[model samples]
Target chain A: MPAITFIHPDGKSDRVETSDGESAMQAATRHGLDGILAECGGNAMCATCHVYVDASWLARLPAMADDEDALLDGAAAERQPASRLSCQIVITPDLDGLVLKMPERQV
Target chain B: MSVSGSPVTGGPSAIPHLDVDPFAMNFFADPYPTHEVLREAGPVVYLDKWNVYGVARYAEVHAVLNDPATFCSSRGVGLSDFKKEKPWRPPSLILEADPPAHTRTRAVLSKVLSPTVMKQVRDRFTAAAEERVDLLLEKRSFDAIADLAEAYPLSIFPDALGLKPEGREHLIPYASVVFNAFGPPNQLRQEAIERSAPHQAYVAEQCQRQNLAPGGFGACIHARVDEGEITATEAPLLVRSLLSAGLDTTVDGIGAAVYCLARFPDQWQRLRGDLSLARNAFEEAVRFESPVQTFFRTTTRDVELSGATIGEGEKVLMFLAAANRDPRRWDKPDSYDITRRTSGHVGFGSGIHMCVGQLVARLEGEVMLTALAKRVARIEITGEPKRRFNNTLRGLDSLPVTITPA
Candidate 1:
């Protein structure tokens, strides 16, 4: 299993192995990570799973879909060019070591 | 903010036997205590100030909303006495009309906004939720209402209905005033009117056929007209229902859920431990703190409730949030425990007018909560929670939380 590390808001980090085809959210949820909430179940309907894409890995991921971009406008945190809805970003072996900064709130 | 010291003899403090105002301050900010008074006073209390009939108990309130024939909506659902008040615009064709006519219009809407059609849009919905959550987890300190609550619904609902991006910010305030206007005219109503001005034209323009997405709900309303179910003119009002009914209700509903979870950490742990509890949490939150607090229905003829006479054309206000917390119906009425079976509570208005957009709300909740439960080991409050200042919705204005990973 490819390993993914999630850094918490408190400067703590936890590592979870990801299934090759699972999105970062699915991987976190499957492993019981506390930082990601895939509300709308990865449907791009609710912005509960907003994440700041790591700058270095930003170009490696696919472009944000129109609906995803529109939803980013409503996220709890400010939108950044690196901002990508985790549900839209799938984790592959090509995307190993992907790091995402979680926002403070997704209420 | 406290009315406790006011005079009780026929003054504003007195809970009038009958014909109280729906838009009154007592009823708007915190109607739960007044609901209890009404249920105790009689099944029907005439609010002398607003001249509207008040039904505080669960059974009577449910009966009024369920029975459209006796308690008609054709005259309009608001206290405006449509004949007297010049509505900023016509009433919601779906919310303001009675059955047979309402049935026909709802049928047209039911056909277009059907579950079968909504299923196709599920992926988009989930993706939107996933992205917002991911981003929020990064910043870690946000006003849940302004950032997530209002933003999420506004982002997804308009696009789902194919609304134009230009001047779409006014949709929530516009719908808020529309829902508020259902009560009597007061400071809240006046505030709503002033707040609603700039957004009125944008909302009206969105209703036009040319502005709608080719196959969106807006387009579907026009299609219903082509099918002869309704006149071309009724399409905008029907689409307006989607815009009005779909937005704040969900945000508030979801906000209530977040508030409950934060208020009760144990329940939050249970949900994370068992992903299946996500759906239960949503229903429990609605029962605990209903979003749409009270909606009125007018009686067509005299009827007795709790030995009180309810005359025809009288307004019956259903206290959904109160009934959800009614001691007569619930055990430990105020507790926010998700483990308890909490389905019967009428958070979504009951009967024919029971919220049609409920599934959408639930789906949004389940997706987000389940995902959150997966990542965070514990969700604890970082600061005091705040509530939104809306008369109809009982929701958190801010929920400061700290998500700790397992």
Candidate 2:
């Protein structure tokens, strides 16, 4: 199992264990991390499970899909350079220690 | 937990059984009490009245929806299973479908109703909402349900769909019949079907690609058929899906929000104070009083949920409204608070089959409430609020309310 670290707005971090092929959103929700809402159940519809990928990991993350890029424009908080929908980031052994910065608000 | 009757010796596991008629008019009027009963019964309880299994707890309902392969929707989302009985109408390509089939149709609709498309239509919808709200506020007293809830959607949704204005009045009746037909063949369903003939015919004709004006959702859907993404036959049915779901659900959703704000003055003031809360307010109202209450999913295979074994082909009624207010899932679940995070609630259901047009529905509710919040200082109920009963939807039919200028 690979471990993923989620950095919350308050500077708190929770490292969650993830199984192969599950999404970062799924790992966060399953671990009771409240920041990721996943309102549409990872369908990329609600844009609630938004995150700012760590700068170091941004280059390694999968390319953003067209719909996710479009929906990100409607996210509740301000979009940043490394902003991405957490649900779009799939967990794999290559990304053993993926880092995500939780946004301040996800409506 | 007490087991009803005797333990089953056959395939399905023995679960607590209750004879609660979910479609009863009285129960529909005030279902919280029954919801409490079902939630208390267990995670999975058998409804002897409807001869179906039910998942009232939020965790189970969420899991069931997230895993559509097991609790499938292709077999009709209503109580009547499509495999056992023929659907009253051609099945919805997106709503009553599973993967692959559901995948293709959903992509077309997903692209059509995507947030990008909603953002494009936002300005017009917001303008229309303001115009309608301003006009009704002049009266100072009106039926919120009919005047605003029904009026706003009827005004803008058709234009968005690109239907001609003449026979547009039939959309509600057509939607009523379509949603009502989701439940059993009760008197409500029968009566709605009786009165909806003309509306249905009109809607059926309008769903055709030629009848719709170009450059609208209907035409956009048809264009996909031309691109070979969707079949020509599935195109009209997809448009029909929008016609069936888009209007009435939003009507009830906006109605529920107005009713909640009127009934709970504090919440209304909260929205008025910070107009940004309009979106969250609508989402809260949806959670507190879910407009689309329940949907049935047929078990694709024998499955064990919350320690109860449901056999293959058994119907499991997922209590969306009950799950919305489940005490285990929400704190002060009964309260209508606008400031809470409500996006995760199942008011719109969850998973891939979740309300495909939710962003559109949210835009309608958000703008309507924002317009009202900006202009109206207080909302007072001048007459009794009446519930508009439908087999699957819960909303107000008439709410006599007087608004004070902000």
Which residue ranges in model 1 land beyond 4 Å of their true spot?
A1-107, B1-31
Whole-structure CA lDDT of model 2: 0.89
Q: DockQ for the candidate 2 complex?
A: 0.41
Provide TM-scores for the models.
Answer: 0.73, 0.90
Best by TM-score: 2
User: DockQ, per-model, please?
Assistant: 0.02, 0.41
* lDDT (Cα, tens digit) per residue for candidate 1, span A1-107: 66667777676777778887887877776766666765444545446677887788888888876556766776656777877778788888877788877777654
| Candidate 1 global lDDT | 0.72
Predicted model 2 interface RMSD: 2.8
Predicted candidate 2, C-alpha RMSD: 3.4
Docking class of 1: incorrect
Error of 2 at B217 (Å): 1.0
Cα lDDT tens digits for candidate 1, B300-368: 788766556667767666777777777776789789888665644688776667676665787777776
